[model samples]
Target: MTLQTTSAERVRTSFDKQGMLRAIGATLTDVRPGSVTIELRPGPSNRQQHGYVHAGAVSAIADTAAGYAAQTLMPEGRTVLTTEFKINLLAPAVGDRLVATGEVIKAGRTLTVAQSKVYALSGENQRLIALLSATLIAVDHVED
Candidate 1:
C-alpha cells in the first residue's frame, strides 16, 4: 500500500479507540496528510437545552480531529496527544450535522500546532460555528 493510504489507515485505527467520539456519534469522514475531518449528527443525545448541538460535543470532535491531524505526520512508533487547545464558539450549532475539519499549521520535532474549523450543515446551508487552535505533542506509544 502507498504511504498515504497507510497513514490514513493508522489514523482510522487510533480513532476507533476513542470512546468519547463513539459515545457522541462522531465519525471520521476524511483523512489526509496534515488534515482530517470528523462528522457528527446533532441529535437529542448531543444537543443542549436550546436544541442546538452542545458546545462540549463540538469541542470534542474538533479536538480529536486536530489531534489526529498531528498524528498523521508522526512516525510509526510515535503518537500525538493534545497538550493545549482554545476554542471559540462563533455561532450556535443548530443543524442536521456538524463537520469539523482540522489542518496542521506548524509541525515541529516534538510539538505540532493544528487548527480545526467546525461547521453546522443544514439542508443546503453550512455555517461556521466554531474554531479551535490546538497544540499536540508527539510521544512514544504506550503498550496497551
Candidate 2:
C-alpha cells in the first residue's frame, strides 16, 4: 500500500483517534496524491428491500470517497466537509464488497470537486453500482 501524502490525513488521524471512522465501517484502502479509495461490505444491517444493499448505503460510500479524495489535495491540518453532491445509481448492488474510488478534479482555496465511481466485485466480474459528483469545503475546527 502506498500512502502518498493526503491533505486530510491530519484530520482523518484525529477522526480515527475519536473512532468516528468506525461508525461507517469504512477504512482507507489507497490514499495517494489525488485519489482515494474507501471499502465497505454491506452487512446484515445495510440491506434494504429485496435483500440487497440499500441505496443510502451506496450513497454514503460515494460521499466518503469524494470527501477523502478532496482531502488529499488540501494543506496539512485541514479538514473537509461535504457541501453538495449528486449520485446516479447505475446498476443493482450485487457483489460481495463495494469499492468506491474518488479522484479530485478541482482543488481550490475553499472548495474542491471530486468524481467517484462505485464498483461491486461479483465473482470474476466487477459491476458498476453508482456514479457520484461532489463538492467539499475545507474547514478549520478548533477541537483537537
Q: List TM-scores for all candidates, in order.
A: 0.96, 0.85
For residues 1-144, what per-residue lDDT tens digits would candidate 1 score against the true structure? Answer: 488788899899888888989988999999999999999998877888998889999999999999989988988888988999999999988888899999999999899999999999999999999999999999998654
Q: Model 1: runs farther than 4 Å from truth?
A: none
Candidate 2 wrongly placed segments (more than 4 Å): 1-24, 142-144
RMSD of 1: 1.0
Under the 3 Å rule for N, CA and C atoms, how many clashes does model 1 have? 0
lDDT string, candidate 2, 20-113, tens digits? 3465466667767777787778776667878777888788878877887787777655778899999999988868888999999999989899
Q: lDDT (CA) for every model shown?
A: 0.92, 0.78
* Superposition error at 77 for model 1 (Å): 0.7
> Candidate 2: minimum summed lDDT over ten consecutive residues — where?
1-10
Q: For each candidate in turn, give its C-alpha RMSD to the true structure in angstroms.
A: 1.0, 2.9
Top-lDDT candidate index? 1
